[model samples]
Target: MTRSATARTRILNCTLTLSIILHAPLALAKTPVATGTGGAVATISEQASRSALAILDKGGNAIDAAVAAAATLGVTDPFSCGIGGGGFMVIYLAKDKRVITIDHRETAPAAFTPATFLENGKEIDFDTAVASGAAVGVPGTVRGWHEALERYGTMNFKQVLAPAIDVANQGFTVTDIFSRLTRENERKFQQFGTTSALYLRDGKALPAGTMLRNPGMAKAYREIAARGQRAFYTGPMARAIVDAVNRPPVAGGAGVRAGKMTLADLANYEARIRQPVASTYRGYALYGMPLPSSGGVTVAEALNILEGYDLKAMPRADAEHLYLEASRLAFADRNAYLADPEYVDAPVAGLLSKAFAAQRRTAIDPKRAAASVAAGDPYAYQEDQSIPLRPQARPLQKENAHTTHFTVSDKDGNVVSYTFTIESWGGSGIVVPGYGFLLNNEMTDFDFSGPRPNVPEAGKRPRSSMAPTIALKDGKPAFTIGSPGGSTIITTVLQTIVNHVDFGMPMDAAINAPRLSERNGAATSVEPGFAGSAQARALEAFGHTWEATPEEIGAANALVFNPDGTVTAVSEGRRHGVGSALVQRKGH
Candidate 1:
């Protein structure tokens, strides 16, 4: 048989196996427990959740399920993430009682320099910058998957990737949101022939319910499945990726010059496994992704400040005010000190110190907001003396990054919270000729105009707000939660944790509660539910200006472990996510 015929037959057989594995009932299923019971998966896509659950039902561990779910998301929710992106994963291995953080963040190519984004000493247009090869970073997602599967997963790389490969080969029904996003970025997609050919049809975006098949992406997946990470990072796939990125744009296309990426950059890439940053909030131990990600330090700093207040005793409005204030102070530090540790000396030890939070807390006025908040001297708190601080740069405009997050807990008590992104929707607008996947525009994540801590540097990963977090109580896993919304991600995660720990809300309620964000010096942005309510007025009374935005805070997904050892899973309903629990009742 021809190669195409063989692949088709294999996909058909896999589909049949998946149908039975996902839908058929087990003969000896465990007894049903309450909501917080059994293995569960929650994510932005329903199909992704089902894929994870199916893996768990087949005896795969949390790491296995997470990989399966993430892979599926790449195919089903291509705009958010794919093999072309990078991310962080926080995993709790129940057997070892250890927390591991994997930083698979994309990095600048070896050819990058401070002036890469500048021409004639002026920053290039944002649109032109993003639609070019210069914006593409050395992808780390494919390598990350292989690393996680080989080290911590119970299953092999091919096993975890099969579900996504099947989906890519057989095609899936597109959702309304997918169709809308495609239409919105139609002109951008049309700028690159490969992208236009893959995502658009007849010079237009595909409509909802279109059975989208990505055979090229399927082929890419198959290569990885057979040859492992080397397939993408060192072999034919790497060459295709480099060629696509380094190719000059066609005439009339909206893009900048080709980048300076090299094969060595791809071959030398490695996903670092680092220790998670840990802090205590109201007796619960919180763990967040460390440097290269500002989420953990920022969230921990805010939680430390909130710890000083008796939030449970305050009225709802006062509670909201305190939360917002704490978030503001935390963000101040984030803007000043957070960057890739390899490139900048991020004072991680001082940033999360409770003493530093205590010192910074003094800046907050219970009844009114500060005229302008500044980054605190965390080193002073650590050394018991003031140290010289750098002049703070103006905060960059909020990034409209598109990302995906998912949480999975297996029956063995292992859990994984993962967040991945391609930097923006339809990243770089340049697809590898035969790969059918978008390349991450992660280079734009840097401070482009001037020399700052996060300026483009060769081999340095961009600073990210993608924090995949886990909370522990009494040295045991309590909750796994995370979200996707650029800088709003830090505040979104802060609110969810507060809702659950202080307000005594269930996992679902905490995830779905109204959200607010105050990053840098911008006006506080509140969701419609809180915009015109008494809470907004109360915040206004505290000298806080506010703006109303549609309820597009963050897509937070969480898995909560109850005191009784039950597990509750919830996905932010606002973003059309779904939650599934792999529980077996007596009848089944």
Candidate 2:
């Protein structure tokens, strides 16, 4: 290895040695909560959970188990994620004693720009764009998997992919959620030849509990297992992906508006290693993803703003009001300034600074919610304030509620918090023929109508709300948590942490608790339980406008490292469907 790589490895070796001496926590299974001594995995699927546990049982590290679980998810949770998409991965290296992030978020093609989503000098209809290949971004999951394995895993591609291939070939039982989503996008799915044949029969969703198989995904995995990432980026599969985008199916008796992807764009695709965004709150150090994902910065800033208050000592209703306000202020700043760091300037350190949070906290009126809120200036908190703060503007967009999050921990104390998506369910409504994968419509995440920072540009990643996070107590990970809920992801993660850390709720209880999301908008959205609660009534006394929604906010998967050395893994009990959490070896 090179000098820098060797140095990093030396630190890694030190941590590995220390981890070897530490006893691992085991866990329970097929349910939302698992506790034991050894290791654990929690996600949206039983197949995914089992795949990781099996890896841990066979002596794989957190990275290996995570990739195995992710591949299995691609097969089973195909609509939510697959090899056609990209995501952010946050990992705590038990050996290195530090956190690292991989920014594999999909990028805009080299020829893309602000006008790509516009038609005749006007922005195109969102639904029309979503269903066309114009929304597709370069597939990044395969390359992302390669990067994760090469950097930290002990197993080969073949070893980790074996389970996923089996699932795809043998099939898994369909559930209500899967059937419902298919029916929701039935018309759009019918438009594409490959997508239609793969997801529907006789213009209807496959019946729930039916064994659904996708030999195409199995073949795709086998090719990657044999040839590596090149199989997707530069080999035969690459041509297939390029064709699916540049020559999308006709819509409304005409060619689609914007599809400019080229083979070179796919060939040049690469995942990056980004420094983790770090901050502190309540005597604990928090580490999250850097730019490209606003979740880390926004969540940390919200917590920092809330730090000025003694939440634990206050009445629960009063404390919740403060949480909503902090979130409002943080989102104003996020919407105003955050975007792809590669294409625009962002006040990274300034956004996370305690001084900035302190200044922003002054806007909170403890007794009432603000009638209106504006973005705060964080540039002053940084030594270099050259990047001027941009004006605030709200992007017109559709809310996507189908992203997925998973958490895994190994016997060596290594932890993984991964969140990925295909943008919307059944992404782009087109599947590459013979590939058995859906392409990502992630580019539509760009602000289609603004001179804003998040406006689409060549090779720039869209700003994301996906936050995969790890909290450290005294320099060791106390717990790792993340959720999937589109824009609500930030608030979901923030409130869950506040619930557990400040209000003293158990991890499982914390996840199941009602969630509220305030984005400096006219109304704050609340779950059914929260909308009618005493707390919601109390918040209304503070002039908070409530928009009660029947839909669940987020499906979160989390793992808590206990003082007794046993680990507790938790998943959402009711959102979407019943999730699965498993431990390698549960205490007797």
Candidate 3:
């Protein structure tokens, strides 16, 4: 052959090889970016979404927009989450290829102990620990946002917080979720006069779209604006927390020993920065919040295991085979091993490994189903022993905790995935009057009668299912996604990523589409809207009990950046006016 002809043949071979790599199906999914300019913003509340867009328009980058949106969310969506609580933040910085995980999770009060919730040999009424003065933890949301802004943001604290302050001071309409949740907890709110006055309007829970202004919250923000994060952590705000929790007025102003929090707990609190739990599927990288939050590891592992299956050809709502098989592996690991990484040595690396996933995937039979599945002994694989966790007895009755989520991206290529919760709606239904929000009943996150580590411990963080996630393709961020659900946060987030990345759905479709999740042998919870008649029938045929509500699991949001330089963003439809936004440079 002529030298030129031979060279031409080699070039063609290289081209084919690259094409195969690019087009080949990956183990994990990648989102199809809908916008060509590659910028998008998403959040659970419309007010928050619009706030983020305003910041982006004002020349703030992704970090600024995210912080602004988060602060706005705290105001507009008070029943679900806020600065009064705590949360986790995951950031993808393109310039340095850095994936930062910030753990601003709430901490147990210093004076707390296992015995605090123990009466005789049995646990106290779970409600005793879950409600009232004792449930509140050391809030870290304020500090967490401040940390992110200091490190990556262009705007100062006041600038970033003004939007939220305005909304809280001037009022935004009460959302449907807020109204429903508030009414449900009206009696609890009325238990404390201060709490009632703040959340209730004319002795009734505020109606949806009622213009609700929280001057107290605005005052709190004012303090934050003037004194920075310290206002909330160590200064007057801290004093307010100390006075309120220790001398809570609910039971004639009883103090701690009577089951209340103290000053020391507030003063000593500090937020953490932890290593992200990372896993790869099909060349795309997934990163999420680490322990004290098992959501990240569980979601990462679930995706890793699913990658071993060929899901595209499976029947829609492939309940007997695909859903159950993938769920069996994921939830088993979640139950047997997942926990607060700070206290336990979880073998996350081994759990998500290709070899480990392959071994587990074999349990699935394409034609039938495994009657039951168990957590295969990790000992079978010789997983690293450096990680140590004392396993807890799984819960007998599923407790409920509600969470909130948001995702943001800027033209500068910074991404943020954040999830926060008050454990349940209008947490404890007990508000600290001047604080402008209800406190979280996060103590419920602990198993009432689990092993030593899983029980409530003084100064320890609770286990959480707040899974905030960011996915990267070819070393660039493809999207940021997260959701608000108690146990289902993991599955809702996992499937959304799969829909976008693996099945090639747009961001809106990925988040709004029907989804399903199973936890620790429970009946699978499929989104009422997402389940098809076929899927529902298949589930019933398999003797699975199913509930079909608009969305039984969660409310999710996602932002996908397309290769063609556009962005597509979506929020859960049931979330009620979940908003979408994009900000591009005028001439770009």
Candidate 4:
């Protein structure tokens, strides 16, 4: 961020803080807004945020705090994420002055084929596949946690896993979101005896404020803490996971399609260390997770396209229109060429090139939106021009607002931005019997009908839009941010950066603001705030089409590093029943 941008943010923060403090301290306490010196964390729940703060207070580093916080989310926010799922992590090691990424995205089992989700020659029912064992992949979160602590954390599983264990064993109050999600997945969850028993109270959603405890999850944590990640992949834990996937434990012994996962798929799973996706916007260095995740490239391409315009000087309506159009153009290419890199030879370098973005930008008109956006060819910008483009772009189906993201920062300048998920709320609707966590339906993320890029294959990871990202200013950590909104995740992160850098909103305000997501569709998905604003009316002259939805777009978590050596952490104040933010110290 520029110095002017930083100044504008601090001013807004101070003004907003005073207003909240003077008007509503009780309500303010419930909102996730914190600033301090030693460390900071922002997550989806107060319980998870405090768990991270407790670890930071014990002198644990940012990575350690992140793992501890994530584990707590598994207990309190079980519908979203846990050890049963997998995701991506972006970390900045202060000592190295470098950014790195851990791609722990779940991998398809070795028995998977291009037609794994197909019945006979036709694609299976999407809803049916989502709730069946066939949707489960070899979970990567357990191995991911182990790999993170082993490489960058100062503490071990025994120490970092303790807080989560406590939370699961002691129980936590069911918030509005937890109950709502339980109701949303009520039918699917009832199909599995173990899942229904844990989440449903007499086949009904638990009321808010009810104390829900998961002794099974706590026991699972204890086993992992005592024996480490290997035991989770090898022994009784492994057997339980496989049995759930293959036999499905349907209540009343009803039949369900079984998965092809075997003991070997679990044992062979490994977290990978890969190069971070590097890009630049407004002279600021941006680092994000690389492919098998389309988030980094798509968001980067959108930003790069926006950089073509002087948005800071444009009218609010014009800027918003440009933002929507840029997203549309970028997503066109994202849908076309991006997927699991191991399967598709994508032009990574070309997709991130400023030249490609500039070329795409030319297609946009300042006063009008294109009727339809088509994918652009980036091969011309590729260093290796010999590469050829693949078949026609195939659209992957994406849904689920149930994934979660969190950000952490330490006084040492180390930062971790992590986004994890189980695909949908109460994922696969099958919690391992006697184990408290839900299994992922991430396999359904793959395109159902496909012989194209992203088609399922043995050991191939599905493409994801989880973009855990960190930014640098003059070669040091500036901010760590991410969100959980399925495909909208890319738009949320991109717009947050644009708001902070170009629009000069403070970190909290940027996240709190309404959002618009245009993914090459005819209508842009717009939050109510923007839809009702005068700017939305003004955009009609530009041929912009808006599809307003009552649902909030994304629940983002972010931490901004101050030049004066302090950090500002923020989580959503209204979305997802409000989020949680905390810090080790209060002032500079």
Cα RMSD for candidates in order: 7.7, 7.6, 12.1, 7.1
Per-candidate TM-score against the hidden true structure: 0.91, 0.94, 0.87, 0.94
- Per-residue lDDT of model 2, residues 1-588, tens digit only: 011211111110000000111134344446888777777677888888777766766778888888888988888888888888888889899898988998888888988888888778787766677777788888778888899999988888888999999999999999998898789778778878788788898878988998999999899999999998988999789888888888875434544544789889999998998889998889999988788999899999999999999999999889999999999888888888889888878887888899999999989999989855878888889999777555764522234556888777777888888888887787787788888998888887787767889888998888888888889999887987788777788888899999999999999999888888887777887777676677778889988887644456778888888898888888878876877877766744
How much lDDT does candidate 1 score? 0.75
TM-score of 3: 0.87
The residue-level lDDT of candidate 2 at 497 comes to 95
Cα displacement (angstroms), candidate 1, residue 362, comes to 0.6
> What is the Å distance of residue 124 in model 3 from its true position?
2.7
The global Cα lDDT (0 to 1) of model 3 is 0.65
Candidate 2, number of clashes:
8
Could you give candidate 3's per-residue lDDT for residues 494-568 as a string of tens digits?
Answer: 877777766777767776666666664445656545455665666655555543333456767776666766565
Q: Candidate 4 — which residues are off by over 4 angstroms? A: 1-29, 253-255
Candidate 1 structure quality by residue, lDDT tens digits, 319-346: 8788888998888888887889887877
Clashes of each: 3, 8, 19, 0
